[model samples]
Target: MLLINGKVLIHNGEGLNFVKADIRINSSTIKELGEKLTPLPDEECIDLNGDYVLPGMVNSHYHSYTNILKGTSFGEPLEMWSLDTVALGRILGEREMALSVSLGICDMLRSGVTACLDHIPHLATSHIAAKTYKNTGFKSAIAPMLHNVSDREILYEINEIYPVNGKHNKFPSVKDYVDYYIDFINRFHDPKGNVKVILGINSPQRANDELMKAASELACRFNLSIHCHLLETRWQRLSADNDISPLFKLDKFGLLKEQTSLAHCIWMNEDELDLIAERKAAVVSNPTSNAFLGSGIFPLKQYIKRNIKIALGSDGVNCGTSNNMMDILRFLLLLQRTQEMDYTQWISIEKGLQMITKNGFDVLGFDKPFGEIKPNHSADLAIIDKNSFLDILDDSFLNQMVFNASISAKHVLIDGRFVMKDGKISVIDEEGLRREISAIKPYLGKNMRKALNIANEEKKIYKSVYESLLISPSNIQ
Candidate 1:
């Protein structure tokens, strides 16, 4: 296949340049990109008609299952937000989880994201999203994450603005969490390509020494990359294990190798920052989610200075508020400038554009010849609306993409195949998924209503116990 006659917005280091380029896709890679390319006799030619071509957006952190938790958790801080989610998750089943993932995938595809790292729980239903990614032409890193913490003191703040909840679970040991990893990869990982079962830990608060150690061993044994949420909130940073940062402790436990990825280090200090740069562990930034949830500004400038690999993610439509990578890039640009009170030294339009394309691929360890459009690179292209940037050209393309571009990606391709076009899913039947999704709501909610009713009754009894305690304290006084 040859994509001929396109105004390619080649994201060159200096700036985005408009070049009259023709891309020849031979199988899963770009055969050539130059002035004139000879096409094979049997090759299919796609005339972009001078449409703008850029690399597809990559999301390093995403929660596909959290899409269903929307509207209910609004205005709550991170702590309350997650507590609300815990209540919601108790009601969710396989079907609801699958529907939420489908909705997340569809939104992400339309929002110009071709690749994503879905940090999902080890649920049978969540695996449907992983399966969908494998069958479609989208790139992905699916980590079946688990949390097993025995103490509340070790747990970090779950959300930015929310207070840490007291200890509520102590049943599952860290060793038990490790045991689940073996089966998780066996069932979900596709060694052929497309899907990879990256071992992911949910958070430091829910993890223990044994769990962290086992994760390190598995990653080393299988050569699988690691993904985990670490040192995100202030409470997590100033927890009982104050000896070091979460990344530092992970490294000390032999978990912070080059293959590891930590999400939303919003509270990282200088020493911790240095360690991440030294270890070469990737940082997945969720700027919008952090900002929206009142999570402090992440150290983007410092990361850029140290040349640490940084990637972008929506975290999930629920946490992130949307599946728009363009919006993330836009927010990041203003965020860095305002945080530092100056932008000239740390970040720029070029860097923001790179985050969506090249930098994102780097986080998944695929940048060199996969993220960018060059000879022999994988043909993962994002076709943007030419009219969207007509008012800006040359250096302005970078400005437009970072500030003015729409979140809707328009069309996307991975491995030289079109997964989405004109905001429609090309690989899956949207109508069928919609029908399945509609049936799921009533089914799961009905069961949830029953469970809630039982909980309500139990709570009534529990309330009496609380009242008795209050009166008993008065009588003792």
Candidate 2:
């Protein structure tokens, strides 16, 4: 396939530059890039009609289950929000899980995201989510979470603040979790295919020694990458008992390595930051989700100074605003600026763009080079109609796309195949998907109401704990 007459965004030695080039794709990789390239007699050709082509963006951290739960929750802290999400997750069977995954894919492709690290929280329906991604030909690293601790145990002083009479819910045993992962890996773990399986630790404080050890061994044996939540809130940071840092705990289990990507390192100290940089691990910052949950801001300046690879994520759609990487990038660029006083030290548009694109691919640890529109790179490109957003094209077009424009891909390709073309998704029957979702709305509505009621009761028990921590003195710097 030959794509001609397009303004392609390419990274020169200095920075990203736009060049008028024709891209030649052979199978799943880009073969050549040049101007006025002629097409072969038997080759299919697509005229981009002077559109702007970009490397496909990636949603570094996301929860596919939350796609159906959008608009279901007002803003709440991470711990409190989890109550509602957990309840809702319990009601979703295989059918609901598939539709939810499909819905997230449709939302992501419309906004030019071609890949993601889907950190699934539910173990029962995780295979459903993975199969959905596989069938749609979407690139994803499906991570079924592992954590035996209850929510109350991970929050600092929550038990003390609101004492419970009986024991908390029993989680699956370490052996159970490990066996499940092994079976899941054997069934769906495909490093060379569209879907891959990675180890998902819910959080360090939440996992016991046995589980962490198993996770480390599994990762080592399978050569899998690790993705998990890390210190997203002050209460979570305080949950590290006996002055032991969460990073140290992870390292003790041999889980902190280059292939590890921790999400939401917002409440970390300089020592933790240095440790992450030294270990060559990556951190995914979800700006919109942090702000929405009232979690502390990520130390972007500190992370950048440490030379840690930082990528962007949208997080859960219900917690954050949108699945759109462009929206996330825009929010991140603007939000990070408020943290730095020096204008010169603020993140540049180029750096922000990299976070949503190449940095994400780095975090996923895919062997084949992607997130670039160059020869030998994976042909995952988003052909966008810049004219839809920009009336007049100029040098500031990229800037406008980041800050002012409403961005959507006119055509999206993943692995040299069109998943979305001419503003319509090609891999799935979107109209049928909408109808399925609509057909179940009444059932969903009834269940969601019950879930909210359950969440409210749970929230009452934890509300005082949340308030108490807000006024407590902090030792963390």
**Best-matching candidate per TM-score:** 2
lDDT per residue for candidate 1 within 1-477, as digits (tens), equals 988888776745655676888999888888788766777899898888767787777888988777876655454345434544555666777767766766777777787677788887645465677776777757777887766652233533212222334355544565665666677677766645667778777865566667777877888877788888876654455452444456766877777878888899877778878998898888889988887666677888788889888887777555646888888878887777777865457476666777777877766754335667877777788887666775534557656766766746667888888888776778777898888867776866676556545545434533443344335423111
Model 2 segments more than 4 A misplaced: 161-166, 241-243, 391-393, 475-477
Cα lDDT over the full model 2? 0.88
- lDDT of all the models against the reference? 0.70, 0.88
Error of 2 at 428 (Å): 1.5
lDDT of 2 by residue, 50-144 (tens): 89999999999999999999988799988898898898888888888899999999999999999999999889989898888889888998889
After superposition, candidate 1 runs with Cα above 4 Å error: 11-15, 150-176, 240-244, 366-369, 391-395, 443-477
lDDT for predicted candidate 1 compared with the true structure: 0.70
Residue pairs clashing in model 1 are: 63-315, 79-162, 149-206, 155-205
So what's the TM-score on candidate 1? Answer: 0.86
